[model samples]
Target chain A: MATRVSPAAEDREQEGDIVERCRGFMCPPVTDINVLQGSKEEMRTRMEMLIMETQAEFCRALQEVDGGTFKVDRWDRKEGGGGISCVMQDGKVFEKAGVNVSVVFGHLTEEAAKQMRSRGKVLKGKDGKLPFCAMGVSSVIHPKNPHIPTVHFNYRYFEIEEEDGAKQWWFGGGTDLTPVYVNKEDAFQFHNTLKEACDKHHSQYYPDFKKWCDRYFYIRHRGETRGIGGIFFDDLDSPSQEEAFSFVKSCAGTVVPCYLPIVYKHLNDSFTDEEKDWQQVRRGRYVEFNLVYDRGVKFGLATPGSRIESILMSLPLTARWEYMHEPAKGSLEAEMLEVLRNPKEWV
Target chain B: MATRVSPAAEDREQEGDIVERCRGFMCPPVTDINVLQGSKEEMRTRMEMLIMETQAEFCRALQEVDGGTFKVDRWDRKEGGGGISCVMQDGKVFEKAGVNVSVVFGHLTEEAAKQMRSRGKVLKGKDGKLPFCAMGVSSVIHPKNPHIPTVHFNYRYFEIEEEDGAKQWWFGGGTDLTPVYVNKEDAFQFHNTLKEACDKHHSQYYPDFKKWCDRYFYIRHRGETRGIGGIFFDDLDSPSQEEAFSFVKSCAGTVVPCYLPIVYKHLNDSFTDEEKDWQQVRRGRYVEFNLVYDRGVKFGLATPGSRIESILMSLPLTARWEYMHEPAKGSLEAEMLEVLRNPKEWV
Candidate 1:
């Protein structure tokens, strides 16, 4: 059972915790754990650690709230490959959910490898297929509370063998929030935290790329924005290894501090049963958009080594179907429509 | 009340009719309705005559098919502008049907005019918003026969005010087919007819743009082609009015010959009641794809100048939903799935 607290109370506690954590944590901390800089084994080991830490932190945060505690149901390790499937069900915060985190290292098929090469990149393998390895940490958090956003984050590193057998690695990751309700302040705080982290890298990075994220998540058919917005960056690689390393580290470190407070504040708020029902209805659209239109979902589903449960983790606990129901005039639902019609810069 | 004939019987009669029609029509005729394009008043009068002819032809086709004539529900003129909305419903070949063909010429909103201006080439619109005009024939034919494909065809001429106060005119249209069943031979016949028409214009045209039509009609989420495919081209405007006029005329003229044979062939075939039911279920996916992802549907729904029935006319008569039911192994459904999984050139 979760200890109940008001939204304001949660906010105060979260703010203090975030501020304290920010002060104590310095960038580029020393790590004694060996992560091989040049080998696929090193990448795989590092990815495994990353997955454990990310999932543990997610569970710890969820347990603090009134929603259910999710236990990892299964973890299947791949033999000829590498992927871990973790599923959870009937939890206070989640219902029938799976959080899959996997790191795979393998060669692409001939056709697939050719397409990659045409994109001005080469892979390692005979028959023109490159020997490439990837470490991806991905999660779908479908919280029990409709007010609590169903969030998604994916961070991955890719490396390929060169002609001389040298490995070249690149980093990419982004965290995005998908909320049922529109709390402008929560959205602001979410983007603000991300912007601050991004500023440490480059000033132009936050605003330019944040707008890109907004455009990216938009469901053009529904004419609505997906969740408010957050930080998203991809292909963060450079000739300089140090620069790429710093970028990935900064993004990964910002995830917990940036999102947890917003989730914490919203989870405890007083919401009517009616609002919860509306939330579920809205979630149905999210599912349709993701399953039907999302490029990431399509790509992952089409991929050979895809873990289906983890890929579909962002689906809601419940959804609805009406003959056709446009939101009532001047309601919160209508307000959401107005916001959607005109894109806003929350940060 | 509808006429029924064997395929072999019709094939012989159809050939005879074609021979008689082509005997004297083979002599190339040169003519121009150029005077009709002199002014808006002249164009309007010419369009009215064309509309009357089009309506008469449609009425004749229906009367001959059913022996009992289908009644036109009514034709409504625009309250604030000049346009006709011809509608009909609950006919022998159609249920909940609407055939709306309109020719309206008027001014556009400043925003709408501005968007047009961004296309780089200025039309005959004023520097700001000027008197904009359009004349077009658009129709959606939804046959009650699940065996017969639901078809859509549109031929439009758009004129906009240029920055210099001249009129910029262009023509655009094409016909497409959506079939419930996978009949490769029928699909081939349909495309072959259209390709022959297009080939008469430019040798390179059919192959290059036929692929475009196939790619455009795809519902990416379902990974299914909209129907067996047909021809589609938009904005066939060029600098020289003479060249543009000839191309546009060719595009619009191809509709009849390309479609008539395919329609006769499909409609004459008998279908079982169960097949009809299955058609409806497939239509459900069509509805989901359109309402959920189609841009044209979204734009029509959002725009003030939209007609609901016309926009939704692309929907099939029936649809089905089951909780995650994959088709039986080695069935026709699986055959369709095979095609959907990997598209190929049928022609």
Candidate 2:
């Protein structure tokens, strides 16, 4: 019933390839494990730097593609941190897009620390201050083309101060694709790119985290995954701090390669009105998952000085929810739901 | 920006009023307190009859007004209950609307009983099966005309068995109005109609439950009430069951008088594309409150064998979310938000 489209329409596929914005800045070569040696604070600082660079580069590249203007809002948190949110709306290629980078440093309140312990993290400073710093790059893109899947990427580094001056640190995040229609080659490309990034860090990266993503993004009520599974790792303090930081660096660095190709693939493809309506419906599911079930979003909403706009910028510009809607049994839409109900091993 | 709308739309103002569907049934007159006598099962059966009648009459009248055919789906729950769902979509006046009646009776597990106790219910069954039965009629109307406010009504009866085989009985429900564009005449009519119903039962009914509705429907994160509240009461097992049942019946019976005149006033009123867009945006807030904050929605989702479609029929067919969306200064949209942030005393 809400199958209404507005005028002022533009398609990314109708547009040509984006002009590269990276003129002279060379890529930071992967730091060797020995060279990456650092204390928790040092690692946090490095992660913060990398995340900011990623946000700038990604937004610039996106701005080139959609020819959309990005509004950059930088604000400080009273609780000892700040963030920069770059958002684009009504772009030629993208409908709504956000790339946010935040680095927060603060001690957890007693109740919060206790909740964290209940969630299974061993805190070294039980009575003392549970000093923590979290840094991350998070992005969500809702493309103009329903055929072009909505994609999300987040990679973060976390440090918890321990008793006796020791510290606990780890990295977490993943990238997932939510398509209005399941395009096989696009899905494969998405997973393969992320798989390559993961394999560069560890052999177990793709398989373990891929399964974790399947579990992590599951929409229990709907009995389906949010999208095709991607790598998701949390509390990943392994081999050494250097190795972990390097791995997160690799994951963070590979975001564009992992997502852009698929964007290009469907950029110009024409879609029927039905497909667009279906896309809106799928987006309704996305909103449901983020608001009702996503822990990261829950934490953000609960955290003091939380930026509501950046937190909810993940929602699509428009969505629909029909009562008890179901696609005809053998339709392409039905096929898409089938795949989502049971995610595929794309790589 | 989602501030866009399509051209192919009609308004309800152009249509004539619905032929009254109350012709076939006679209202049950209130019983005097001294003469009232009924067992728990007898009272529950009477409530069920009244709710079922309400659902049928409401849907029949709506069908005449909207010129939209209703699809009736009746199904039974695995948990010793069943429901009837009447849905109309893409109507002449309503984009989507639903009227549903459910009668459910089942035994609560120990954990569920504990949760009830935590909510301030003094359940007698500490280690035994808690017997419970609930009957209710709930309806949500999402009109096509942006000027026509969305309305929701619910009245329910609950009966719980104590360890000593004694029954605890009560009635709870209210009707609320959510307008995309606030109209003073409409707000006055809505409150006055509901006030008349409340005053028939008790002098204090309007004030106490109006404040409660204001508190209950608040969207905390957005700092706004969900709508201009009507009335809401729970666990009202006092002043005799006869008075309570008669009060809820009076409330339910007055739904048409409360909403029909407003719908008629705005039905054919022309609106700009911007107004329709704002309506969609406000509906997004409605969706947020129901999904994130409504305890009834949470209960519906958590309860075993809950009819998902009926539970979610309250959602609008379409919604839009724009990042950091603020209405233009001194605009009608802005004024609506101002009132929502500080709910008014409308009479």
Candidate 3:
């Protein structure tokens, strides 16, 4: 894994206008060449290379806006795997940004394997080990500017391999937005960008998956949605494996288009101290949702001997929990709450 | 319950010495007294009064130190019982102080009832309704001064009735401290007070309960203890119900001795902005433990029609999470973390 980043990256980023700066980016670097070797382990390595490359590109794109670079930490799990966690703090654009890529393959614990039974077949190793491989890239960005909305995206693949060389696999992940102040046009642009990606694969994909995103990202205890929803789908072995992989890749492609424009639009916009305080307050709900309810986070934490930092990279840099906080009735803050209480068809 | 509080309460709090101001506290006014009727329902009310009185005295002591009176909020659950929540904010001493007493009795959903079977037998109402009653006072105090430690204490009593007029009951509770910067003498003082209280009732009580507290309050993901341990016990239905209640009350009585002197010791002690930042960072750990791993919080949140505010009073007014933060070696902050990593026999 490469760790060095050029210090002048942001200065170069400022030379071009928004669209010119963002366009014509190449596909993420792919280095794994053993895909045709016909081995499950090689395939797992191929997927790992994809997510690792994706992590590199995503962090590079964010570096352009922030003027701060990532410090990479490479760690290993004694049980079987390791991960690379790239983190940035106190950047010009982002208050905190963490993009983690983990490629872990090992014998699943009994509890984790049993939980997996609901989704697909659990293929054990020749020695009766519950052999499993998982690779994913999950990123959460909390920006310094309140106008620049915080965003999160994660795409993961999992596979179970059996003694007879049979395999059962599935794919999961999504991207969502959390804005301190809701901009109707921003919300529409976000959803529309993702809808286009989904439409290319299947007409029904956009609507069904959009609804899934709404339900999945909800903060139940607060009785509010985490943000204006994007698209989410999981356990996608349904239509066909090749088709599923293509759809996941397409969704991954949309993440930059889906979120960066809003960042570009509001990156230079200014506000008051009160507005910043309001952003910190709303970030508290994001903390509650992840630590208290997100199934992936909980599942990751519960997995025995998993690396803690990589799993918790989703938390914001700072949050506030005011007692019985009630937004002033009919204010912009109140308007945001009203929308959060009821989900809408963003398209 | 009486809702009116004297606005002059805060002015009066500043007149006396620390111990003098804390003593001669008035019990909360009791509005339920059907205990002598020899019904399970009446017994639950009696236990409710005990916790309510405890809550009132606890708040009164905090007010003296804070020079700020609490605002009371009374609410009811549609299922059965209600609660009184006393909260203090923007005080001279405390940033946020919440003391809540709830007496809830009603049917338990099947999943909840099934989980409770480990404690005792569950008896349902005539229509197959699983009857349960819970009464408790849970409090969290967040201090304004960084040197003064944050504290939490909770005491609860529960009972389940049988069809044949037989009763099954138990008691559970604890008090613990979370110091931003640990003072060794202070740690010894806090634990010694609780140990003396425990020894008065039983010789084995302090050691056993202290160990339990250590294990229970641990933040496993961080590979660190939440704070220096105090005392915790649950499912204490052994020997006799009256004995268990006395043991729990004894631990509850130790709450003030365990924490107040440290407040008195550090209340006016000057601290740096960096120290305050460190305190907020530690508070972030407190938030992580409660929302992610605390069993009571999870159970309470999952209970349908539960009062949301009272259940969430443990959160601090503010917290911060910097990525992969490391305290400088030989620094006071690093010293506090050392003690947290390896607990001691503070006596």
DockQ of 1: 0.04
Fnat for every candidate: 0.00, 0.71, 0.75
Candidate 3 lDDT over residue span A1-347, tens digit each: 12212222221212323233223222221222343133333446545545765677788888887788888887777776677788898888998899887777787777777777765654566776767778888899999898888999999998887788788888898888999988999999999988777777777778888889989989887789998888888888857766676677777777778888898899889989888988988999999999998988999888778877777778888898877888899889998888889988878
Cα distance off (Å), candidate 2, residue A59: 1.7
TM-score for each predicted model, relative to the true structure: 0.50, 0.88, 0.88
Query: Which ten residues in a row are the worst by lDDT in model 3 chain B?
Result: B4-13
lDDT of 2 by residue, B1-347 (tens): 11212211221011221122222322221221122223323787567657866776788678777777788787787877777788898799998888887778788867677877886888887367788988788999999889999999998988889889899887889999999887888899999888877776676788889999999999877779988888888888767886677777778887888888787777799999999999998898998888888888877776666888898899889998888899999999999999999999988
DockQ for every prediction shown: 0.04, 0.57, 0.63
Q: Please rank every candidate by lDDT, starting with the best.
A: 2, 3, 1
Q: What are the RMSDs of all candidates, in order?
A: 12.7, 10.6, 8.6
Off by over 4 Å in 2: A1-41, A124-128, B1-41
Model 3, B1-347: lDDT tens digits are 12212222211112333233223323232233333233433445445545765776788788888888998887877877787888997688998899888877776677877777665654554565656777888999999899888889999988766566566678888888888887878888988988877776677778888999999999888878888878888887765765566566666666776787888888889988999899888989999999988999988778777777777778888888888888999999899888888987889
B1-347 in candidate 1: lDDT tens per residue? 12222222211211222223223321211112243333324434334334433444454554455444443432333522333333444456654333345555557766666656685645554455577666665655556677766666666666776667667666666667776667787678777766766665556556766666667667655567666567766566643554444444455545555555556776567888767755655555555566655555665565565555455545433343322336678876667656655555667
Residue B34 of model 1 has an lDDT of 43
Of 1 and 2, the candidate ranking higher by TM-score: 2
